[model samples]
Target chain A: MDMKEFKLNYYEKLYLARHFEDELMKLFADNKVVGWIHSNKGHEVIGVSLALAMKSHDYIVPHHRDRPAYLAKGLSAKSLLAEIMGKTTGCCGGIGGELHIMDVETRIYGPTGVLGSNLPIALGIAYANKLAGNDHVVVCNFGEGGSNRGSFHEVLNMAALWSLPIVFVCENNKFVEFTPMQKHMNIEDVARRASGYDIEGIIADAFNPMETYETFKYAIEKARRGDGPTLVEAKTYRLDGHYEGDPMKYRDEEEKKYWLERDPIIGFKASLLNESIANESELESLEASVHQVLKEAVEFALKSEPLKVSDTFKNVYA
Target chain B: MTKINFRWAITHALDEELARDDKVFLVGQDVGESGGVFGLTRGLYEKYGGWRVKDTPISEEGITGLAVGAGMIGHRPVVEIMYMDFISLAIEQLANQAAKTFYVSGGKIKVPMVVRTLAGGGFKAGIHHSQSLESWFTHIPGLKVVYPSTPYDVKGLLKSSIRDDNPVVFIEHKGLFSLKGEVPDEEYTIPLGKADIKREGSDVTIISYGKSVHQSLEAAEALAEEGICAEVIDLRTLVPLDKETILKSVEKTNRAMVVYEATKESGFGAEVSSIISEELIYDLDAPVRRIAGAFTPIPLGDAEDAHFPTVEEIIKVAKEMCY
Candidate 1:
């Protein structure tokens, strides 16, 4: 967990997630990848940094925009690509497509399609851990828009009142779908709402992986120490449109340019070079390796067979 | 054999399962110190403590979602929805999450959980507290729907539900809570999808479950006094329905009647009647009849009695086929 190693790991995962989304966008345009694609282009650093702070056995109930989180949890890129391609070799055997990618073996509870639905599930998993006399924490990820859901309030209250070992991470990327945060709610920060639940609310610079990692690490440790849940709000922006095919008419030019200038990957790379942590050549090699990994993932997914129609009825029961 | 009330039979099943497996735990509103709204989980919190018999917030959706997650992690969680009507709040968790988790996970996960709720309208608890919604869970795949009538059936079916590897919706009639029935003292379990023959006859067959089974049995007795033998088949489980027992009874009697406490429109009895007509069309001597609750909201007071099918109505339906 040295700075050099952490920098490399963060850059590698971010590159993988970025390239994965890029490839998915291409495939989606060609109609090779089915279903709606929620790109994690700008939110990668936030998801990956938080994921890195979690233990292997600890549960991660991910939001739909959690490609980097899955990569950080060590799920095979080929399996995720295969899932997007609706292949039998996918993580869920192609039963759940882009919206639902789950791996029980990795303790990644998968992404919930419904807004804020996984919060209670994550709280329950933490409850189970507490009941079993374990200190394992559960991390529940959702967007700023999902914070308005009743489940958000219900789960937070339960988790706080019971002193459950869990962390609620809200990736506040400004806009929720097509609606901006201001239009959705009057509050400037979603974390401020956590005070009502009697939990500490903290905000982090989502574009900075180091900041997100350190913040989530503290929150996760506090949870594992039986200190109850903490609400961490990461201020970031969605680099791309809400979905792959979203029209860009709703967003203005200046707002988009402001976020693009502070793009996490470019900023992190500049920091790595300026701090003399990694030379330009080393960063180039890391980027090349990530490209190779994603190329092979796409190849594996393309070569995998699509699930048969008969497979639909296979797991309907035990 | 020992005689116990229906509620105790359920409590005994919970106690046994909690003792049998360390992973089994109960979560619901008022299930701990208050012993549940209906006292169904009485004495459980005292024996197992608060950790096992947990009292949760009045959030059905939250509790159900929590149980689904715990079940995915190899814990058998039995969630109690205070009333069957409130299950509407938890349909997303139960139908979308719990019922689809196993299938959507591609067999990677199993949601071994039970949602215990009370149905029927005999107590006059009004619209919110009393409603027969067993058909809702029966319609969902990846979920087992169990509605037992007698204390013996409730004990056995509940044990089977806890051991089941899929999510099970166990519906107990509110009116049948204090009904007494003979249960075996020794350890035993009745398999799901198996129908129980409460009474045997030959003239006609009456298929029902839950509180309706009692009415059907009483109607059969009345029919027997009039020299018209009506066989009664209590369908223990609805989803994994025992079509074999139902069809066999219909084939022998050549007359079938489906009884239920829910509305007639798209009720569970319609499924039974359809099955009888589809599979045993040639075995019937008369058109299959369904005696169900009136297609309206269950009203309060004595008006609720008119909403549910009475023993007299069952006897009349049986006589219509007998003549």
Candidate 2:
């Protein structure tokens, strides 16, 4: 895709995610939505860009804050909203709420709430792919704090040793559910720890869709070619609190302002205009279309019926 | 028919499964070149290449999660945790991820994997190596727990566990690995959740599994010499418990005695006693008795015998229940 087209598509994804979460926050406040939601507001580029680079058959194991990644991997916004609404039309038939959204058809394994739990699962998927003689790559996304989990180290070592087709993306959004990055780890970059497993590690600017796309594209391609796993640490910030209604007192206003000013959506818009990649009208049209899509998704979710009590015991076994 | 030890029975089961289905593979520490620490997976590594029989690093959590993941996506991965005590490291993967995947995903996915781990305390491998943790897995709703006593049961049940569509925790008693029994050369499979009556009598019913089954049988024989007929029922699977067999035996014998290697408090034996009491309370001639290990960590080799339930203890318990 050309730069203009890529920029336009990236802007649409960012707008859609931003708008979807904004609608969800409203639904949560009015008691329409039941469970807690981890907004994917600031880290839209990280999930969308990486997801855009993946094939339909390739697996994407997402963290809680990865609705954008699911959308990028072809999950219908209506289905995502319905899932959060605990409706029967949801991807998992309302069995898995927001934290456990899964679409097997799209090969999206999970959006696990457990901090680094998906890493090893992703390794297994990649291992299965290799054993089946398939070149499908598995992408596992987690937060910076999740990198400290034993699963991270153990899975990386296995991936490196076995040369499994997988990519480990750490969305280092600075805070780990209220704890600052400094307090959590001594290192400045989680990517640096990847070398301990004898794998290549790269740092990318998550706020920049172009940079994230290019970095993850390279890693994904390398994995598909049987070169093993890569740990890509995307530097981003969580614009909101850890979850809806989280006090978020640990971060200062100045820090929040610093990141808000460099909002990925705004930054990408300026880049598109300044670089003469897209005109103002083109960007505006894309933003309008995204808003319309989100509006329809909300409507679809509202019309969907909640799961019945009779079906509660349906999914407990095969 | 052929006579084989419990360890070789397990090996033969794995070999048959791996040869029968290309998707079935083994992954665990020391399972490849070393053929497992117990030699249970001996020779299968050479028969099927490294791909089918893999030697993983000592990462129980990682290996368990990997097995769950692979199981979900069309591969049947049989992971060995070496010792059941170390299952603590992989509980999150087993209890949370693997167990919940099928249920949480609304049945869109199924984790068809078997976690084969060595349990029991005769080796005196200390607290870290020796434990009877079958109760822990049985408590989890989405897991299938299997504990086999003899070579015939191990071969048949292991094969059935591999082919099962749900996540199964297959526990092998380390002490019983060398115990031999007659196994049919023809293919056979013992379905999970079925109880086997090794010996049937009419006085007191002794319900047990794993190594405790052998102990119960010995106790039953001793009781028979004294004209206190004892029926021994081996509950091969704990999760899908054979409640019918247990209740029937309790009703017929008018007495029930629970035996197990795990601690007395909240052991699997407690579940059996509870089920019998709850359903067949009026049929019992006396309150159910239990013969179980002491409520303490398994000590070193010298003190291990004192910790586990002895055959003599089972006999004593059966006599009390019968009288």
The 10 consecutive residues of candidate 1 chain A with the worst lDDT sum are A104-113
What lDDT tens digits, residue by residue, belong to model 1 across residues B120-144? 8888978887899988888888899
lDDT of 2 by residue, B1-323 (tens): 89889999999999999999999999999999899898988898899989889999999999999998899898999999999999999999999898899888878899999999999888777998889998888889899999999999999999999999899999999999889899999999998999999999999989999999998999888889999999999999997898999888888999988889999899888888889889988888999888898999889877999998899888887777766
Tell how far residue B153 is off in model 1, in angstroms.
0.8
Error of 2 at A65 (Å): 0.9
- Candidate 2 off by > 4 Å: none
| DockQ metric for all predictions | 0.77, 0.81
Candidate 1 CAPRI-style tier: medium
Mark the regions of model 1 whose C-alpha exceeds 4 Å error after superposition.
none
lDDT at B56, model 1: 92
Deviation (Å) of B184 in candidate 1? 1.3
